[model samples]
Target: MAEQAYTVVSDSETTGEEKTSSSFPEIAIGIDIGTSQCSVAVWSGSQVELVRNTRNRKLMKSYVTFKDEVPAGGVSDELAHEYDMLSGAAIFNMKRLIGRVDTDPVVHASKSLPFLVETLNIGVRPFIAALVNNMWRSTTPEEVLAIFLVELRAMAEVKLKRPVRNVVLTVPVSFSRFQLTRIERACAMAGLHVLRLMPEPTAVALLYAQQQQQSGHENMGSGSEKIALIFNMGAGYCDVAITATAGGVSQIKALAGSTVGGEDLLQNLMHHLLPNMDDLFSSHGIEEIKRMGLLRVATQNAIHLLSFDESVPIDVDLGNGTKLSKVLTRTELEEVNKEVFEKCEALIKRCLQAAKLEAEDVHDVIIVGGCSYVPKVRNIVMSICKRQELYSGMNPLEAAVRGAALEGAVASGISDPFGNLDLLTIQATPLSIGIQADGGDFVPVIHQNTTTPVRKEQIFTTVHDDQAEALILVYEGDEKAAEHNHLLGYFKIRGIPPAQKGVPEISVCMDIDASNVLRVFAGVIVHGTQRAPMPFMEVRMPTVDDGHGWSAQALHKMYGSTLDLVTVKKIQHRDC
Candidate 1:
């Protein structure tokens, strides 16, 4: 095995300005880069149209193969056989690994993939590699994603006969703000500028809104508000959203997401068939890699078959005197992945509760995504919403990308004569953004499911006597404990002027604009004064990057609550 050098386009060499079509009428494209598949669509003057590759396939496998001297992605690369993709040379599931630390459970789960995923169990980026020329070639998730995006861009350019620059991408709601930066970085690396990143369910809500508006116009009736419960479960994530739709507006009332999906189901069944699967693949020899790939292909085929059949047979012959034979029933498959189904149900219920809506209030129950084909997944969503059927207006696989295409047109200022372009999707925060206070407790200023383009503030007081400075540790998540959540960044509010504990007032404000940018402001005022002692500080969120987990622990170890602050009460402010 020998090390090989590969040259990639660096982002520093590119222009810093986000390329827009302000000079010319260019429509941004919509792309849905899923864990297993990817698609690109755009508005073709009058309506949204899906773009097809040279192979005439609309959905391309999301992977990058390094078997050749030059890396190739699924967008243009064609394999002789499906087994070739699982031969340790193709890297898939980059979506699950992007922006995740080594200590993340999701990163740990990704170790089972054919490619090399090495983690030190520390809060840092995991090491990923693909087999090329009999040597393990190192790569980052962001780099692999960028390579794939470049291919997608090339294909779109060839088809549309125009330069593809601006794009609207759809991401899972569970993605953190730091994770979003990774996505933007990948786009930048590919020389593409992202106009917007809509949550998967919210994009679907936009498409639904347009449908409802058309229906209202046809009936010549008032465009009444319709409450929709949307459940989206793809290969790597599951998301739930409750939206209020009227006319052409889709106002997202609540959003909940989790890292549970089809991948978990496949892995569970693979392990069920071979209990010693992990132990067998630990060596990573050529024979072992082949054996693992064989088992994976057989298991994947069985799962897809189970979607339409009562039972599917999985048979694979792994060389070195190993063989597997099993008849997998649909019920057995559901039982094996019981936790996945339960999580999907829980997300929907949690979203409904957050929106303060009952199951009866849902006028339409929509299920979309790759896993929506599974009987158990569909049943769980329908049963939770107490509906006999799901809304079948859009394709399960193409709904998200289609909605993204609609958004690209709308954001690009394209107008349709039939009012199809008159639409908007008002998004909400998918996770609560707050600070650590009251001894490691998470006190949220902007709670989850709160409408975005919002500004809210909370008042706090010093926790210790004679405290002149207070540390504001920003975090994001729904956890009650601050340490369990994702740390976005931190700052200090000083010049409090010597004061007794719980006397001085500290105003911490959080603002989210229409573009989904987050800015945190902190200021302090003395006990007997109406004005602050120092100027207010405002910092954009997600300042911390890799090793954020370690940073949070180190911050606690160094300060040890010396600069802690406790909650006083909410501040009365107008939320816009």
Candidate 2:
């Protein structure tokens, strides 16, 4: 019953090759690891089928309890009561915590949960722990997720009567390349191979494409390309996507998302219910943790009830003669989470604008995820798209996993007689990839929303006269400042022929394959020739992991622009 250490797989160990043959193809399953819940699905030879646990439930809570010497996940272990999960012995919401630095605001907000989330406010991983046998037991987000995934894999294996290995996972569009690496590591720990990490909204878009194909609406428009907008808001993230579907192909035009969703709304309501909740539970004592758990349960229940009823009564009694009793109106709940709603609205609009489409150009609006049930959320999405009703073809909660299943079949090269498996989801980069140039400004070599399986080259020059070397600081984000973005990695291009400022042409090429793996190529180019003066340095992206933000600062301090490059003409060549 002792905790076991998991071996984190290196990028070299996992290839993006399909492990199947003609006689028998190993079809991958789809997994949607939501902040609050999780689900698994697979292609059942002809159609997509949602895999249920032993309890015959399609959905399972996303949490892991460490009360006993060994840990148990929600996949196989049933909680006696909802309050048991909040008893400081269960760890949840790891989707929001994984790969985030301690300086992140989301990490700071998570401290109020009925568990220990200690942060130093520095650029490093936060300290997370769960109470076990009245002692603080430290653990990492990846470990908890691996334990849960192991259970999921076991359940699928038992149900399907085969070894479940390859999987397609749904992730937030806002997740950085570094964050994705962490997710891959978790999958590796569970002895599963990640086939693809589809964006949540993009996965929804794929499901929309499938539905359109089945309903004979694939060519509804005159141009045969129907534009649809997808909005997905789960517990930890909100994502938006605009796609053009035709003949079962969904080309994602744009993607936008943020780390704001039902969790924020829940926290906002909890704070509104108890104005001094933070002060009341600062100590995190046994009694205080119990009280926080009670209040959280009350607030969560009220939120769910207000989604249907106009008003809900919330009543809870704390041990220290503290009580909360009030009539929570739907309007008041919406008011408390005004910022969250606004953020969602902004994301949808941003995605539309990025896709170069107007509200009227949208052929359909698809809203999915747990937050889609909220009337306020529905109104906001409908208002933004100027639509009367959301598309009712797919279930809000199951769209992502279903889409992932479809993708799994396609990626695994499984063929269907009825052509149901004839589907494709063309993805776009969710964040811009660039290098720090021109006095710490982010110079994007490959802009966000660019179609994937792409390769782009941007020419840069040395900033200093007669500079022999230049440092390439890679980053991922849309931020104008390099330091404000997520640093992917850094490398040096040496042996540059001593040239004057802006005289040398350093061609920096970036390649993003269909699986979203990034590899950066940089070398010095000789003028009047289409070749590099030296061997090109090809390095995999996200070389720097763990406390990358702080590493960026340290890099700046040590070098201090001693090795800098400025952007020249950008030459792009894309393959989609």
Candidate 3:
């Protein structure tokens, strides 16, 4: 056997002396990387300490550059405050694009964000467009994430003077499997072990409910006030859930969100104020002025301020005190932000309707996410709540991150897991459960939108006599074609005996865990049906198909040592 050496990717087990620096072997940190700002907080012992910038400010601009090397800004360790210093940078609206199809509504909306759009194409991926034109250097979404993680870890490292190990990450419920995988890999690359990934709304609920209980409040209502809705709107994304509070434990009723958030509203405001910015690409070449990188940011700040009050007097520091000022009235900005309100309203209504509650039926309205600071946004949510007693105390920007840190504390054993928290029920994604058919229609074992942690089995048969193996590909999403939608994974059941056609029965069951990650199992239904039924196991995943990874022996049996590239290409497409 080859000499074995295992690397320590996570915390040391309980064999050693208790770690004195942290309550748990692994120190816990929660990072909220948002569009306008990113915040990193640590739950060391008893209190949570948020790392401040040089000026003792809490928020850090989610900006990173990749020129000579990747450098980041907005949270300087230095003692100076400068926003314009850069090497070649990209900001955080990238979160809005994660896990989206190229044509998604939010992807379209992200283009309207206050950043330069790079049209230059470099890689085979669309993520490249940001690089070739120099709006941001060519960087993968995962790489961008790695840079952010590096900066955060450095900040914590400076504070502790020791390496921080274990962490829990929070992703929006909107994340697809690939995006989640990418995030996990980025953490691995950054030399941190991810203990778990809690969805944003769920973490927020835990944080909110826990705090309420600490203040001597529980089960905020009996039967009359059974449920409350969380309206989480931020600059980069929006999430809303109808959480039921029985004695103050918030449980998810149903949840939904999108890449479109307050930033989109800001863009809408910009188009109203500066019509010229819309023609930025055609009038001025993208590479030149796009690299200047300040026009959209100035406008977005003005728009964000307007959300707080009815009107905000705008100031754009073009340079040398030559400032441009204009007053954007509530009505004018309202016309621009109408699309955002409608989308939010529709999602909220859908969630409420699914929970079988009318707008007036919901009891308490808890608004969160920084975007909720907008006066008009508060008004809209209040109208939906239809009750004066609704509590809107939580700070949206800080709430999710704080909730995430609390979850981290619990996860890493720094805090007690049995500690009381508000638990609410929420809707599952894709809305239906089904198996694929020959013609592409979904034969639902469980209907779409059903509550999850569900297991429904489907059987498959061999198409050919004397078949030794079978392939079952599972998928998620709403599409008429098998080629479209998300292909979660492909399963291969091997070691079957030669049998007549349709003799073997393959059972496929899928289960969603508490955290909602999916697992798939395939096995022979009966021991005699094959030899011994393979034990039900995990969801099979795909591997990168780099031809070079194969060994010489396997390669020789498949093909001769020297082969034509044309023949290899032919085999790839014509394997069947």
Quote model 2's TM-score.
0.94
* Candidate 2 backbone collisions, by pair: none
lDDT of 2 by residue, 1-576 (tens): 122454433444434222433357789999999999999999999788999998899999999888776788899765543666557888899999999999999999999988899999779899998887778899888888998898999899899987777899999999999999999888988878999999988888888887788777435443388899999999999999999999889999999989999999999999999999999998787788889888888898998999899999888897789988889999999999999999999999999999999999998999999999999999999999998988888899999999999999999999899878778999999999999999989999999999999999999999999898889999999999999899999999998887789999898999999878899999998866545556989999989989997898899999999899998754576553
lDDT of each: 0.88, 0.89, 0.58
How well is each residue in 466-545 modelled by candidate 1, as lDDT tens digits?
Answer: 89889999999989999999899999998887778998889899999988999999998544546668998899999998
Better of 2 and 3 by lDDT: 2
Per-residue C-alpha lDDT of model 3 across residues 1-576, encoded as one tens digit per residue: 000111223345422423554453665788777765778777656655676655666777665544444345446632211233211234455566544444445555455433333332221224422332344444545555666677777677787666766676767655656566767766765666676665676667766666555554443444223566777777777777776645545556676665667777767766666565555533223432342345565666676666667777776664534345787777887787788888887777777876778887775578877777777778788877786654755666777777777767766656444444233334354334344544344444444445655666666655567666555555554455433444555545665556676676666677765555666777655654445645654663322121111221243355331220110011355656
Candidate 2 structure lDDT: 0.89
Deviating ranges (above 4 Å) for candidate 2: 1-22, 217-223, 528-533, 569-576
Error of 2 at 286 (Å): 1.7
Candidates in order, TM-scores: namely 0.94, 0.94, 0.75
Could you tell me the lDDT of residue 277 within candidate 2?
Answer: 94
Sort all candidates by lDDT, best to worst. Answer: 2, 1, 3
Best by lDDT: 2
